[model samples]
Target: SRSLLKLLEAKALIELSNQTKPPQGWPSSPARNLEIPPNLNPDQANVLQLFQNQREQKEWLLWGVTGSGKTEIYLRCCIPELEAGRSVLMLTPEIGLIPQLLERCQRRFGNAVVPYHSALSEGERLATWRYCRSGSPCVVVGTRSAIFLPLPKLGLIVLDEEHDSSYKQEAPMPCYHTRDVARLRQQQEGCGILLGSATPCLETWLACQKPNNSIGLLHLPQRIAARPLPPVRVVDMRQELADGNRQLLSRPLLERLSGLAKRKQQAVVLVPRRGYSTFLSCRSCGQAVTCPHCDVSLTVHRNSDGHSWLRCHWCDHRDEIATNCGQCGSTAFKPFGAGTQKVLEQLELELEGIRLLRFDRDSTRGRDGHKQLLERFAAGEADVLVGTQMLAKGMDLPKVTLAAVLAADGLLHRPDLRAAEQSLQLLLQLAGRAGRGEQPGEVLVQTYDPDHRVIQHLIAGSYAEFLEEEAAVRRIARLAPYSRACLLRFAGPQASLTASAAATLLNHVANQLREADWLAIGPAPAPRARVAGLSRWQLLLQGPPASPIPLPSEQILRRLLPKGVHLAIDPDPMEL
Candidate 1:
């Protein structure tokens, strides 16, 4: 090795090596044989026509059902703008979707598609930035952070999956949402803005309802080829236990999986959480083992070799699994809930011939991990895929004949107002992943509260019905859509400082609220009361629709905040 190194060094000494540089400018060649689809559905055609003719419409919301051709519409809308010598910025919520989106865009626009995200190396990002500044028309697809890019002659902005909470940036000053920022940009540039989603955020829906509002709504109620939505079967866990069946897979789901495996089809099992067991609890003392850094219990995780550990979801802190109760020193502990790992293990045991693949945070840790796992599953390497909420994103897997929610009860009982709405959207989206091909699809949702509103809505497959009921409740309660709300969060290492700061802010806001139309909710603990060793508290303020109220200035508020306490202001946060 030393001789080889000496030889290589001597060879390099003859001439200094040249440093490689990133590619300059965009691709010169046009897209290779890119052609438009032969035809569009009537709903799709109508929406495209409206967008093309109404150049005056600054903001438009496209509410399409899952599996509907929203991306196609976005591509179609960009053609005219690109041809007119204008650029387009398209945003999605996840980095996992970037590769697929980039591929689609490249097929049509070729090298004009520049991807902007944190994952890009500094040189790559700088090159893309320089290329965008060259006054040439191109398409950029990226996550929320892409909204800040300086694209000259920007003609159109598209926010695909706009309802996703990932669009919101919580950290840093001037916290804002991409959808809102897109609207602001549309106003400034006189460019068309399009927000597409299967489940529209309530605020956007309400804006569309306003008679004088500038936002317009376009609906695509049918999937391509008029394929019927998969039939959803709601399985009551209580009945399953009563019938002497105690397993992650409900009876219907297990039967469907067996059938799929026999027929050489694929399936996806979704669990909202990622660890093996949700948490460990002492059977003797009935006390749950909680995280040292956070208020929540530590989840149980297992490796391929079967060693178990406790991990906090919020802080990513890990520790050894407790063999005995910490408080009473009793050697009686049990797992209380299930996550992706547990479901994966159960499926391996229950379905003998099934080739199972786990697709969660742990399994997808390496670079390009998501793409590899998805491709493996897509290639029919796995008979069933088990994962978390990441599986519900806009993944187009056609061979998946079955999709199952191992536990829907966990999603239904969140402390947030959008719980039911989110739950419905997740179920519908997961179900939509199946039956995309010639074979019909089936969905099985197992939940303790089978009669819950979210479960019932999923079973009925009626988003409008669910939204109407939720809207009425929000109206009566003066929640979002009926009013405007903001969350002020304070977190610090010291609990007293966090609490006191939160209380002081709450009182300050309360004193400013003279009219009954404005209200302040609390200076109470945040839903995630403590995370990463920081104690958290929050205060929520709500104002009536169309009402302007005076409040503390950002500068004054920051100066008044206690030292060591960090403040984050989220306007219209998806969660409280």
Candidate 2:
């Protein structure tokens, strides 16, 4: 009876025992005057036809190049579903992308477009949940969390930028990926699912290649109206240094930014980090300032009122920067590495009277922070928008003629297997932001290693070629897309205790799975040894290609580990 009441409250089941009259009918459907866009290109039109013909297909991948009118294809596919009185759920990887996408969906579908994301207030989310439960046909545009929304008569699910790591929930319990959940929903609701991306993850690409796989493949090879992808020019930082130029902005990139005002165009500058500097180091001892709580260096953050402090990006720990080094008691200190704030400061100093806007997490805060900054940039309030990786995701700005990446080496030199692939994806996605309009766009990538594989692929604009090569390497090494992995993380106040607990749990699982295809990899310290004062250790369970690893139940795991130690099991973890 309690469960029945709960279902009634969620509008999933209506009670008729106490009703004297018939229940009221559902609310009136919104007016459907969908503003259909111009005709789709041949590639997109072909995908639409394929989608229509394969009604029994449960999943499809739309592998389209950037600026190839993928969004138009999405709109076209949804039109028929909406007309059939079914609902469409559109998912984006980031909340920052919601505003632009929401505006477009609303413009096209009118009041039938429902915007849902974590950024919305609790009350707003509750109202949306209720509305979707009303069983009315509508389109819901949101981020990864939107996968959980209940849609009656769900006809389709669309995941844009499916390659992004944001779709994976790394923290908290019950870790999962949005795409996996979407597939689960498809199985339950019998609806079609579409994954659209410019640079698809190796896993999805491989899945589509299987001979009898249910996932179909759709390709859009060219940009709409025959506009070319932006040409990328890699600037060797080593060469720039040899030429007596040590500025963060390369000579050519600076020259381009300098003429933005005269050329009457905008530019987007992407910096990997967000603070004024990556870390503060002692000149004498060469020791960087480290966070007390986290096992990482403290970043230098400067406020508008001429105040600076040290912050740990991992734990949000803040501390005052000491004048002297802790290790050597040296008075001389230097800030190392360029961040978004430093880039903005450099631009203000290099170009006179040039407007600049910082678009990173620090700059965008509160409920409407992202939308406000984006609107300002779109209105031409600033000539240059300096930001972090958020600038690389699915933003369509027609007037942006130049896109520049600062300190690209930071992105390339990550300690992850997918680093190169992700780097190329980010660079290409950022390049796509430019050249969407009338003028051809130019991309400048400043890196110490200009001939790096990722950089080379970026210059050639050969995403498929890069994927092919990368697949070979991954296949050889038995990495992801060829193997299955689950990460078991243990954290506690004491490092020794946490490590011992992790080791015990690993031994327990290994003994149980000794005869199975799964292989146990570690009981070692995590990549980040500690965070927010908790010592962390991890164990990885890997399986054969295309095989699922069966992990121990959470209850059994908790019982095995020490009482004070916390355990988190992540299936198909995106990050190590």
Residue 374 in candidate 2, Cα distance off native in Å: 0.8
The residue-by-residue lDDT of candidate 2 on 159-247, one tens digit each, is: 99999999999888789999999999988999999999999998888889889976899999888899999899988999999999989
CA lDDT scores, all candidates in order: 0.84, 0.88
What lDDT does model 2 reach? 0.88
Q: Per-residue lDDT for 165-267 in model 1, tens only? A: 8898887656788987887787787888899988887778878888886789989998888887899888888999999998777878777787776787899
Where does candidate 2 stray beyond 4 Å?
1-34
TM-score of each candidate structure, all chains considered together: 0.93, 0.94
Worst 10 residues of 2 by lDDT: 18-27
User: Ten residues in a row with the worst lDDT in model 1?
Assistant: 18-27
Q: Candidate 1, which segments miss by more than 4 Å at Cα?
A: 1-31, 507-509, 515-517, 546-549
